[model samples]
Target chain A: MSYRSIKLIKYPTQEFTPDVFDITTQAIPTPKEGEFLAKLSHLSLDPAMRGWMSPDTESYIPPVTLGDVMRASGIGEVVESKNENFPVGTRVMGLMGLTEYAISSGQGINPIPKELPAEAILSVVALPGVTAYQGLFEVLKPEAGQTIAITAAAGSVGSLVGQMAKNLGLTVVGVAGSQEKCQWLTEELGFDQALNYKDADFAEQLKSVTPNGIDLFFENTGGAAQAPIFERMNAHGRIAVCGLIADYQTDSPAPGPSWLNIIKKRLTIQGFTMPDHIHRFPEYAQALGGMLAKGKLKYRSHVIKGLESATTGLDLLFEGKNTGKLIVEL
Target chain B: MSYRSIKLIKYPTQEFTPDVFDITTQAIPTPKEGEFLAKLSHLSLDPAMRGWMSPDTESYIPPVTLGDVMRASGIGEVVESKNENFPVGTRVMGLMGLTEYAISSGQGINPIPKELPAEAILSVVALPGVTAYQGLFEVLKPEAGQTIAITAAAGSVGSLVGQMAKNLGLTVVGVAGSQEKCQWLTEELGFDQALNYKDADFAEQLKSVTPNGIDLFFENTGGAAQAPIFERMNAHGRIAVCGLIADYQTDSPAPGPSWLNIIKKRLTIQGFTMPDHIHRFPEYAQALGGMLAKGKLKYRSHVIKGLESATTGLDLLFEGKNTGKLIVEL
Candidate 1:
């Protein structure tokens, strides 16, 4: 049988827009020893995919080179398997992605429930969920009664951060790119306040909402938005920077506010990668999963129709078209 | 009895230059019910004083008012006092002032031993000394066998940070302004290596010394010293921002070299004020005083002659002239 795979056949040198990918059909490979073939149901499209296209090297994984099927995370049903650990009809999710069918050699992939929906194995219930959970409680560690203002608060991780902050009794404020997203942040996600960063009076609105000062800031999109908030930070404030999508796709250097304010406020600004806290996975899945099960957690996703639209789904994130996690269902 | 005391004038806005401060002697009042009086002996001339001169806004404390005597930490003798908690002739070191005398309302001052030379009390035995101790061990928390780099290596806090990091079994690299300071850091202060940041290839030399990347960094000077070190930080590296003296006196905006790299490296950069860790002072003083008394730790100081010369001492710190602590002996 033949399966189609979308690969980044050309190296993107400049801006990471469309027309940089190549999709083709190839015969599905047969499983060897310790291998399994899975039928993909869902795949995650993330802004980090742009970083993969860049020439920067990573420690554990090889850079995604030209003519290679782009790497991604997805969940699928095992149709055939020779490996005893992963039997046929079992389900798994991990870095096995961007295709209708895949043969896994088992580096990082792990088997899960065959009955679980693909959405659970994908965006909000997957890495984005865990990223927000660990980054909020573990990395930022805002105390109860403190105020937290976050960018992209309508997006997956940011939305979860707002909800979790509210649950943990923190005063939550959100900054979104549009009015609708801001509305969603305040009215639906239960954030104490929301600011539309695209508005001209956005800075003023941010000040009005957090007059006492921001005790904790969860930075997802970093750029111009970081300036005014830097000035109004309280003494000993903390900033947890998980993503800087505002400058991710652009090649030009992004200008930032003065570093003096960071020192003046005696801030603790930290950058964290989620898997680094993989040691706390069971705790997170247990705690956040319990929150999810209790209906205390709320998450949303903008899912594109098919694997062919995965690339477009990612671009929407850069344009701020998608409010939450953007996923592609095949 | 006639005693002259200086009070906190209005908050200072300009640099600690000549026109920035005014001196007036007022009759010192007798200690009331819970009050005490101390005759100032030696005053700490610190880079942190520059930050205290910000606009009449909130900081770690209210900005020293315009007409109030300049706020400072000093080792002084209780010349006359009524409070039983602090009797006559006892030497106490605490946040006193630039004035010759201070009358406390039993606020934050603690009376001490008359034996500690005024210079030693103001130098390595007091706030600056305890600052380096707590900042390096408590905030930066360097691990044994790891590499640590400290900026302003010859200054008060930097000198002590180098020694404390060294005592913690870290390979300490200190960056100072002058050749003499560099030599002193390595030869006298137990730093494994020292480099002059004024060198043209200073960044390259730093990279060579910290080949494994900086596991911990004591950031005392921000502007030029911190920019290059940002690129050389290891994953999960911790930076304790003790001070930022390089730009302390500058009115213009300083430079920033895309600290977004802070995220890719997964670093933790935290700025700390000593008073925030005041609860840990007794513990810190015990450890540091023991280290000093045992001859395991050593510190240096640049002394300026009288209260009138304190302005010149402040400029010496800005010019990076004095090695180790800069103090004004009255």
Candidate 2:
């Protein structure tokens, strides 16, 4: 039998185009000693994928080399196995790429629990949950009664972050692209306030909502909302820069606010990525699973059909079209 | 007897001109119970004074109230005292203002050693020295072999920071505005490399000097050199934002570099001011005094004569005309 996989043929100039990837069919190979062959059930399309496709090698993780199967994280069930740890019918997850079948030597793959649905595993117990947990707790170090402002509030990572902060008794203010996303943050996730960045008087609205000024800022989208929130930061405020989704598609990203405020407010801004803390994944996953079981965390998946839809589906994240976690199902 | 004093009659529009001050003669008042009288000797004119004169009350310290004595730090001798800790003939230093005499209740005053010259006290063991110590050891937390790039490298605080870092076995690069200042950094202060920001190929020079990429950045001036130095930071770099002297005088400060690099490099940028760390002054002062005694620290004073020169001498700092620590000698 043959399997289909998408390969990145060319690096993008400014933004990703459909021509950058090529789909091909190859014969399914058997697993070697200590290896397993698994059929991917779901693929995750994340914002970090843009950095992986770029030519910049200085990023937290090395970019996916040209003409290689595009890098992605996914869930799959072991169909054939030579390794004792990962037997047939075991559900596993890791950086398994955007393909129907993957042969793993059991290096980075982890066997997941069987009871959880594929969407729950990919959304909560995977990259988004771990990233949110690390950025909010470790980087920002939120304290109860402290106010926190998070951008891209409707995105998978941001949604988890706002919920966690809210659970900890923080005054959470969320910034998103649309009114619907704003509503979801305030109505469903229990965020204190949600502001749409597209509004004409967004800065004034932000001022009105955050009367005491922001204390912690979880920056995911670096765009129009950044300056207003930064201006309102109190003394000794901390900022955790997790992503710059707004600038990913453009060659010329906008300049940041003046450093004068940095000195005036005595602020601390730190940038982080999940790859640097990969060893803590299992610990974070366990904590996240408990939260999910306790009904303290809520997650949604924007599922697309088939592996072939993965290439075009990524733009939904960049364009802010996807309502929640962008997932491709085979 | 009457004493000459300078008062802040008006706040500047964008830059400090001579017209902002009002020279006045006041009767040297007697000390009340528990108060001591201070006869000022040498006054220190620092870049932080600009923030004190501005209308921004959100700064690290409150702005100097209009029509009040202009705030400044100076060394003085106690001529009369009702307080036992600071008796007559005691040498003390604190925020004594722009005057020849001051009255103190010993709230912020500290007694200094009589053997040290006023220049050494103002240049190394006072505000400049403690600031450098806190920013280097407490904020940046430098390791032995790491590379550090400091802006305003020839200034009092920057000079002390470079010498201390060099003594700790770190490769130090200094950025200055003039060739003389650059030479002073490399030749006199023993900086590993000193680049004049005015050089047309300053960025190229910086890149060639810091081939290993900057691991620690002591940001003092946020001007032309900031973007280039920021771009060269290595992964997990730490930046201590101490001052932005370049932007202090201007109504429109330049926008900082894009924060995209902050994520790609996982950089940490923190802003700090001495007022926030007042309680640690004694500990830092003792450490700095030891460094000076061991010949591990060197400092210079650009002394201007008379109390009236204090108004214009401050301009030397903003205009980059002052060669060392700007001081006014009575």
Candidate 3:
């Protein structure tokens, strides 16, 4: 069978667009000895992909080079296998890329549990859920009654962060781009309050919702939206720096919070990557899986059909168009 | 006896010049029952004074109100005493203000040991030394052989930070304004290397000295000086945010290091005040005092005579004119 794949043809100098990718067809080769071939189903489109597309600089990982298939996490069905671990007809999830088929040496691929939904493996069980669990519990250690304010509340990580914080007895206030997203956070996710950052009175709304000032701020958006929330942080507040989705498209990093307030308030801010939290995956999977099974956890995926739609589908994340985990079904 | 006192007549709007202070004469008042009087000797001048001078804001302590005596830490000889715990002729250290005499109810005063030099009480045994010790070991937590780059490396706190980190077996790089200050850091204080931030090739100089990348950054001077060192920080670096002396003179808080680098490097940045670390004072004093006694630690004081010099003496710190702790000898 032939498969369609997207390869990065050029390094984006300004902003990332579909023009950087070259869509082409190639023959799907059979798995060699000690290798397995998986038919890719759902490809995860994330904010960190912009960082991966950038030219090499000081980073946790090297930038994805040109002429390579766009790196992504995905779920697939093992159609052909020579490896004993991943037999034929087994479902798995790993760095399957934005492609129709993947041949792996079984280094990173993990078999998904039959009881869990296939999409949940990509959304909650795999990357976003693991990230939310670690960042909330380890990085931003909020007390039981402390208030937590998270940005990108309608997104995969933020939604989970809100629900988990609430489950742990902490008050949660979510900040999102639209009223619909805000309503979903407050009404469905049980967030104490949700503020639309696009609203004229966002700063005031943020203050009204978090009357005692925010004890923990889960910073996903890093720009103008961050400035006001930073100003309202309580003394000795903790900030878990997860993503800077706002500055990904910009040439340089956007200006951060006022250092004066940071000094005056004695705030502790830490930036973390999810890869470092892999050791806690079993711990997270057991907890997050139990929550999901008990109906205490809820997740949503904004799915787009076809491999050709990968380019435009990613832009939806940058524009905050997707309401949850952005996925491209190939 | 008549004594001259510096009082804040008006709140400083922008840059702090001599005009905000009113140097006036007042008779040395007698101490009431349960109160003791001390003849103020040496007073500490700090960059944090600028923050204290600001109108009411969120802070660890309340802003120094107008019409109040300019608040400062000072060494004094107890001339009159009603409180038996503090006998007359006892040399004490406390918030004695910018005055020739201080009347205290023994709230904040601490008696200084005769074995310790009076200047040492104000420099290493007091605020600056305690700040450096805690920020280096407790907050930053740099392991031996790790590279540490500090801003304001010639100032009271920075000078001590460089020395302490070196004593702990960490490689030290100091950042100062002039070549002389940089020389003092590397030669006198035993810093591994010192970079003059004012040099034309400061960025290159920083990169050359911190060949393996900075593991701990003792951030003292904020603004332009900090931006370059931040880029040179290694992954999983720690920043002990001690002071933003560079931003004190400005109307607004200066922008800090790039949030991108913070996320990319997974930096742990924390702002700390000495008051918060007061409980650790006993621990710091024992360790730092031992180092000072064994001739392992040395300190300097830039003493200006009279309360009249308080205004210009403070400017020296802002301009990086002082080689060490800026003190006023009354």
Candidate 4:
């Protein structure tokens, strides 16, 4: 058994400062029927987690409870198992709570390969990867020669969505919070162009970037930054809404554009929860992994060292600090 | 030919006062190959006609040019035809440009039954009826026990939409401008509830009418009226925008509510032009006519006596003066 167990003892309410999270020692418990215990390896820290702590206003998902171990999906080794389905040494990933030691009842857990390195398992073929792959390829259905726009172009899901659309021959433009992220999106990710949303002329930049107008929009951030941009979308545009990272930090609710223009343009905007696509996870992962293996797609992970720094990783996401996927390694 | 041949004509614009229309004689011409010519018998006067007069906007259909013998769809008889596909004396409904004698190149025309009364062809089974049918039945797809809220609920399209939704087992609630129209919708049209938008507590009335939150919104009006109603839509609700009569009356542009709430509720809003569904016209007419003949469906036509009253009919539509379908009989 793993001697050391790290647990997120409390859920954060406001902006995730260092004091908001507490990591405490825990005794690894025995597994009950249909249950298996996992030693956490790669913990995913996403902007969506901020939404999970907000008051259960209206969302496709529920918020994490108080005094409970914070919820997360991560890849780790099954050190102890009471279920025959997942025996010892079965490396798996799914909704394992944020802790070094986790006892999952096999509720949503699935086996990961031992061949792949632990951290890469959380990168190339993880939930974030599937989100990008499915939302772009399956939902948005962008055509070649069409223009596509995505917010947070250098982040995990947005980067992959833009790159996938690019690989399919679409003209890709990215919007990012900083110039460095914009540069990386254009130069490194092969995006046709990138706009620094932090600039005062961010919305105006959209008109110039997509002169003919965006045929597809992969909505990542949903606030003032994303609202004005909707007017630049072409007729019959399809938008696959993955997350609204911008509103996650706000105490007030984010309002949408009047959308009279959206109606006239015949835009289709659909919000999806990734858990709804779990059945096709393996299919999405394999296809994207093949692209990754062939050096076609790449993603960066801003990794924090230990469980004690988990809040730092989450804080970085809220502050728009990181340029890519934020992960915590314990 | 029968002696009656009353025709509609236009005067000038830049003002809404009289002298906007003038009548003149036009030659009767024969239909060429693949075309049919129908003698104008009845013209459908609708609220959408107001939007069609503007020369600048790129609407679903092109605006009628000023000084043209105003464009309209009407029931007509094939008095003379050169085309073999359509024989002489065959009954037809065509875009005859609001003339008693029209040469239709079959751009937008449908054949009406010889047996059905001429007035029936201009009322139900026409643009207004099929628009309500296709939009509510096809696009919205509401289920039994669900609530449907229709604005302009006493207008031709809205009245039919609420009744059809009711036939499909939805609890239909209507919103009209006047107490009389609201009473007509509730008592005469069998809508479960009706609210006068002019009521001091209009928003509260909307809440009371659709206590479960509206599942489908048949949006016939878009303006100051639509803003508050959107807040009463349930999660995953659908809004089918057929006409925006409210904005067409104003010389200035219209603005609607900002769209942020659509995401939180995961709602879908779509705008459509009915002729886009020309392929389903025959089917739509059959179902609508069957419902009408069986007394399962009721329709009212606020018919102006002569083509000279077309201007009055149109003005009446903008003023919400008519209860149901507005038409001018020659």
Top-DockQ structure, candidate number: 2
Q: Give the distance in Å from residue A237's predicted Cα in candidate 3 to where it truly belongs.
A: 0.4
lDDT of 2 by residue, A234-302 (tens): 999999999999999999999999999999999999999998999999999999999999999999999
Candidates 2 and 4, the one with greater lDDT: 2
Residues B14-81, model 2: lDDT tens digits: 98897889989989899999999999999999999999999887888899999999999999999999
For all the predictions, what are the DockQ values? 0.50, 0.90, 0.81, 0.34
Clashing residue pairs, backbone N/CA/C < 3 A, model 2: none
How high is the CA lDDT of each candidate model?
0.78, 0.94, 0.87, 0.75
Q: What are the chain A TM-scores for all the models, listed individually?
A: 0.95, 0.99, 0.97, 0.93
**Local error of candidate 2 at residue A311 (angstroms):** 1.2
Q: Would you list the rank order by TM-score, best first?
A: 2, 3, 1, 4
**Per-residue accuracy of model 1 over B1-330 as CA lDDT, tens digit each:** 554434444444445555666667567677777778788888888887777776636667666676767778888788777788788887787778787888886567876776656666666768878888877877887789988888888888888888877787999998888898888888777789999888999999988888788888888888777877877788888988777777677676675556567677788888778877788888887777788888877777778878888755678877887866788888
Q: After superposition, how far is residue B49 of candidate 1 from its true place, in Å?
A: 1.6
Error at B198, model 1, angstroms: 2.0
Worst 10 residues of 3 chain B by lDDT: B249-258
Best by TM-score: 2
Error of 4 at A153 (Å): 2.2
